[model samples]
Target: ILTTLPRYPIPSDILTKQHVVHVQISKLPTDGVGLQLLELNDDFQFVMSELRQYYDEIKKLKPADEKAKRLHQNETFEGCCCLYAHFSENGMREFRRGIITGQSNGLAMVQDADFPWIGLVELRNLYQIPRHLVGIRQTCVYGVFGGFNMKTENERTLWDGICREMCRPGVRNVATFHRSAERIDYSGRK
Candidate 1:
């Protein structure tokens, strides 16, 4: 019935059908008792590692595109993250193999702040005032293979980490816009 009605595909990182390996430590992992490390299979670990690597790659892109003549060289401009659009199966596979393929530059995903399952799309923009800077902002959707599993508090923490990693001293600014219970506007800066 749901399928018969108008429906849109959603992207999800953590799906109920897909088994995810999680490790829990009540106290701390000690060598004898506290140090019990949960073993994650190579496949799961590898997938997680790949996701992290992709995240890193997305963070590294300059805020502005090369074609911008006036603001291309400016260094103080900040970039924002937005959603791209849904990709094909091939594109999804390429995303999964981002480390080896290095073909993430062209792939697009949906990114809607209102939706829980959104993909990311990156764009280039310009800014000037304190300093001229050019860089790309990202657009994101939940993605077909992975869905966000973070809780409200966890989401904040993850956002903090992403901003922290994206912004570095002397580097260009990275801006993030989030709208949920409260709207948060931040320029990835100290």
Candidate 2:
């Protein structure tokens, strides 16, 4: 499991999902015996402003001409692309940052933060992320819910359920675990 720590001045090693980030967390490995998150050093507001700005910029991008689009599509199918794709989770569909890990027949295998399973997405659902955004690292780190004894079948089942719920789309409160319980909660609006 991974735990997030609040570091002062935002260490250089810490990477954010967006270029302009107000709050950053340092991810570290945990022994699975402590709390899932640590308290932040300062009060911070978690907002989707950066994400909204990203989508706005994406919307402004002009569609590539047919020839160029075809070339890019071919590259993607060959697993030579790290691009954005429309992924569906918990009945919610949205574009997510992913890379083409593998391909078979007409489907491309995609890996992204929204789900643990590798998604098989059609070529038409994939889009080349704008060049500027392609370099940005993923905002959240993947971690399993701790304190479960996987040796037992029952515990394993429970652990899997917890992970499924926590990773469900539109759940912003997972990131807020580092904040105090009394703090105001914000919905992860798209």
Candidate 3:
């Protein structure tokens, strides 16, 4: 018999200097399990197209002019209320909806809508999102994946294993559930 449950500490390296984006849940996690999510693919695509056009317009401006424009935009927008272009690890970039949560020493801490991490982006990378695009709702909804009774030793071990795997660098974890069938796969990024 267990007297109390053990609390596991989140790995600091996994989310160092990052802030988790808060999302509203229609129902609490304790209400049920295996909840399915429907993403608005068409709307997401439309927003990406619009962002591309915005980026192109910025590119046309002179380097000094562009820097000034971005600085001005950063000062005007509120935190977590606008979209921004975040460059990927491969040098390619993707437009993610984020808000400037904080700034210091010319770097802005951005909380991306879909990602589980906050990005410390350079001020030059920030751009002004068009007003029309800012009002579009987020396309994806985030959720808690599992509900475990931490008092049980077996469940605690299982949860620990899952956390460790998710913390690994360059490994993308994909979880897909349909009609009660669940699949989880991990693939390494190049």
Q: What is the TM-score of each candidate against the true structure?
A: 0.18, 0.44, 0.51
| Each model's total of backbone clashes | 43, 0, 1
Global lDDT of each candidate = 0.26, 0.40, 0.49
* Candidate 3 residue pairs in backbone clash: 80-99
The 10 consecutive residues of candidate 2 with the worst lDDT sum are 22-31
Model 2 clashing residue pairs (backbone): none
- Any runs in candidate 2 off by more than 4 Å, and if so which? 1-85, 113-117, 150-190
The residue-by-residue lDDT of candidate 3 on 1-190, one tens digit each, is 0000011122233223322222222232322222111234456578778877877877799988777656553353446455466745356776666667677766777765533235677766777667777665554433345466566788768766765665465545443321221221112211
Q: Supply the TM-score for candidate 3.
A: 0.51
- Residue 46 of model 1: what lDDT? 49
lDDT accuracy of residue 30 in candidate 3:
24
| Every candidate's CA RMSD | 17.9, 11.5, 13.7
- Tens digits of per-residue lDDT, candidate 1, 55-166, equal 4554566745323322332232222222222233345422221101111344333322212222333322211111111111111221111123345777657655643543
